[model samples]
Target chain A: MIQFDQVTKRYSGGVEALKNLSFSIDSGEMVFLAGHSGAGKSTLLKLISGLERATSGSVMVSGHNLSKLRGSQLPFVRQHIGVVFQDHKILFDRNVFDNVMLPLDIIGFDRREAARRVRAALDKVGLLGKEKVMPIRLSGGEQQRLCIARAVVHRPAILIADEPSANLDRAYALDIMELFKSFHQVGVTVLISAHDETLMEDYGRRILRLKEGQFTA
Target chain B: MKHYLFLHWQSARTALAKILRQPVGSLLSLAMLSIAMALPLSLYLTVMSIQDWVGKLTQTPQITLFMEQSAETADIAAVSSALKTHPRVKGYTFISKKQALTDLEKRNGLNGLTEGLDGNPLPDAFVVTPASLEPKQLELLQKELSGLPMVEEAQFDASWAKRLYGMVDLGKHLTVFLALALSVALVLITHNTIRMQILARRDEIEVSKLIGATDSFIRRPFLYHALWQGLLAGLVAWGLTAWLIAVANPAIAEFAQLYNERVELRGLSPLELALVLGCAVLLATLGARLAADHHLRRVSAN
Candidate 1:
């Protein structure tokens, strides 16, 4: 569960990314954050993942309070909330399998078990056949799928993506949405920020619209 | 426990693979590490071996008494009887003026060198091995014998023994300073290497951070890198020191033969080897930890 109570995030340059925002995400709800560029969508996801602390309000992630938690405790919270970055953040040096295998390695999963999970996550994203290929050789859509595979490899309770389908074609975009939907079906709380409104329309999940730094009508 | 070992083994392999990918750079770094480590180790061995050899010998300080050339047989006999009765004197050998010249000639094989001399220039001497090697006691005995009739001078080479100990002390200090300086240098080398590695793999680090990798997990491969480097450097240094000693021992033995003794120069003991390797690993690991931790903080803060 993720809860934000009047959370306000102010960057170092005095730009308010989030202002007096309050919201709650239940354990198994799939929500979409809708806004154009500069609409605090990324900041919201960052807060949920414990990547950034709120400037003035409480941000609670899965019973762990982000504001009061120590630095060492942040990783434990993050381990339960997988984050897929907007830029894809896929390691270009490693093959697809190693890229996805990272999260399990961090949590010290059993070796054979981790291998099975890596291949399983790869199979889920339809990248199983390309497990040995370097991420640089993968197409943009396939690379995006690679990021999703890495995010879900550890089977996190909450999965959040920022602009997951921004540059992909319409079909691939829908396919990405279906992937998140499938995870939500398995009782994984999913929150995603996207490039536009129509991409999230068919899902019928709650859409929180933001303008500037506050939620809009 | 099995899982922990596997993780460590994986980390170590990862580190080794990274090093192997750039053979020349890694070899250069290892070469630098070994030379830095070898210098002090070799010096310590040398000083320790010399000290050990010197310690095994007698510590008894001998006092030599030179008699007047004009002294009669009766005066020499009187001095000898006096030394025999002295409680501080353990034993004494009296070399006459004639015997001293002949012995010197025989030792030098210079049968004709003394013929040109008008008479024997060497003095008769008594070498007294004192019962006590104490400096004060030896000094007192020397002074008492110097005042004896027909005794021109009494001498003991106490300063030679003092000089040997002084040199050993100085060698130890030099070795310690070198070791300390080299250890710091090695730490800094490892820090810089790991810092560059972190920068080069910034994407991995940042992605790992977002995906829930802990600070220690991110830091593991780099620590293993340094640990392996340190261990390799230590082993190479030991090998280099051992090789250098083997080459030097023959010359050292030959020199000892000149002194009518045999010396087999010893290398570092097994315990010292373990200690050197342990220190190397510890220092390198510390360097890597500091670098990785500093960068982790800056990366996470952003």
Candidate 2:
């Protein structure tokens, strides 16, 4: 579950990225954050993931207050939330399997368990045979799928994708959305930030729109 | 703890693999670090060997006893017999006034003139050599020898030996100071290298952090990179020092022989080698930690 109450993010340069944004997503719910380039969509995901602090509001993700969390406790909170970026953030030097295993390794999973989970996650993303292939060798669609596989390999309670379909073609973007929908069907809370109106229109899930720095439901 | 260690090892392995991808760069960095570490260490080994040589040379026991000119033959005999009977005294020679005059004349080219003298002008003396001449024991022996009833004065002529010892002491202190300064420089060098690496890989770190990787998890690989760099550097330094010593040993031996002194150049002792390695590892780890913490904090803030 993720909740934000009047969240505002103001940079020291007098720029406000998000202003008075209030939203909540219940457990296992699939939601889309739609906005323009600077409409606070990425900032909202960052706040939920505890990657950025809110300037003047409360942010609660899985019962932990984002603003008050100590440095040492940040990792524990992070372990419960999975994040995927639009850039297909896969380590190109490593094979697809190892790249997917990154999240499990970060969470300190046992070796045998990590192997099992990596295989299962890769399988779910339809990348089973490509485990040993380097990420650079994969197509753009597959690379995005690998990033998705990596984010969910640890079975985190919540999954946040920041512009997950921004760089992909329509076909690949639709495939990724379906993948997110499947993850949500399995009772994993999913939040996606995107400017693709057509993609959001097809899904017909709860949509929160943003303009400038304000959020409107 | 076991889990943490396992994760750390995995991260380290990944880092090693990544470095292996750029073998030339890794090797060059290692070579640079090794050369930096070995310079002062070789100097320290040479100084230690010199100290050991001086120590061995100063082990011989020798003392001088001076007596008054008014002392009689019986007093001289009593002093000689007492010295001969002393447990620490290995040998004693009575230098009578005539023998002393003869020795002085031979040295100063006054032999013929001294032989024409009417009477002996030199006083009675004794040359006593002890079985052991450790510094503290030699001082004690000097005190006891001066306490003899017939002995008017006892001198140990330890000035030359003391000066040698002082030089060795000063050398050790200087080595420590120099080693510390160089170690600090080594830390700076490592820090700069890692900082460059962090700058190059900024995007990777940001993505990792954004995806729920903890600071320590992200830092582990860099830490391992630093550790391996340090270890390889230490080995390199050791090899360089050995090579330099080998090249210089023959010339050093020849020079010592010219001065009528047989000195052996010593290699690093086990403790010294261990210390060098430990210091190298410490500096590298410290540098990596500093760079990672600084860059990671900034990136997280951004």
Which candidate number maximizes DockQ? 1
For model 2, state the Cα shift of residue A182 in Å.
0.8
Which residue runs does candidate 1 get wrong by more than 4 Å?
B1-6, B56-58, B112-114, B259-264
> Which DockQ-derived CAPRI band holds candidate 2?
acceptable
Candidate 2 lDDT, tens digit per residue, A1-217? Answer: 7889998999789899998888889999999989899888877887887777899999999988889998667777877888887666678767999888877777888889889999999999999999999888988888888988988998988998989898888988888899999999999999999997789988889999999888665
lDDT of residue A130 for candidate 2: 98
- Reference A-B contact fraction recovered by candidate 2: 0.46
* Fnat of candidates, each listed: 0.78, 0.46
How would you encode candidate 1's per-residue C-alpha lDDT over B167-186 as one tens digit per residue?
Answer: 98999999999999999999
Over the stretch B1-302, how does candidate 2's per-residue lDDT look in tens digits?
98878887887887778678889988888877887788788879888888888777666657888888788888888888889888888998888887888798886778587657778777788888887766787788888998987677887866476788898889888888888888887888788878888888776787677666778877888888888789879988998999988988899999998777887777788887898888898899999999999988877623
**In model 1 chain B, which range of ten residues has the least summed lDDT?**
B53-62
Model 2 chain B scores worst on lDDT over the 10 consecutive residues at: B107-116
Give the CAPRI class of candidate 1: medium
> What is the per-residue lDDT of model 1 for residues A1-217, given as tens digits with 9 covering 90 to 100?
8899999999999999999999999999999999989999998888888888899999988888899999788888888878888998888888999999989988888879999999999999999999999988999999999999999998999999999989988999999999999999999999999858998888788999988889987
| Model 1 DockQ (Cα-based) | 0.70
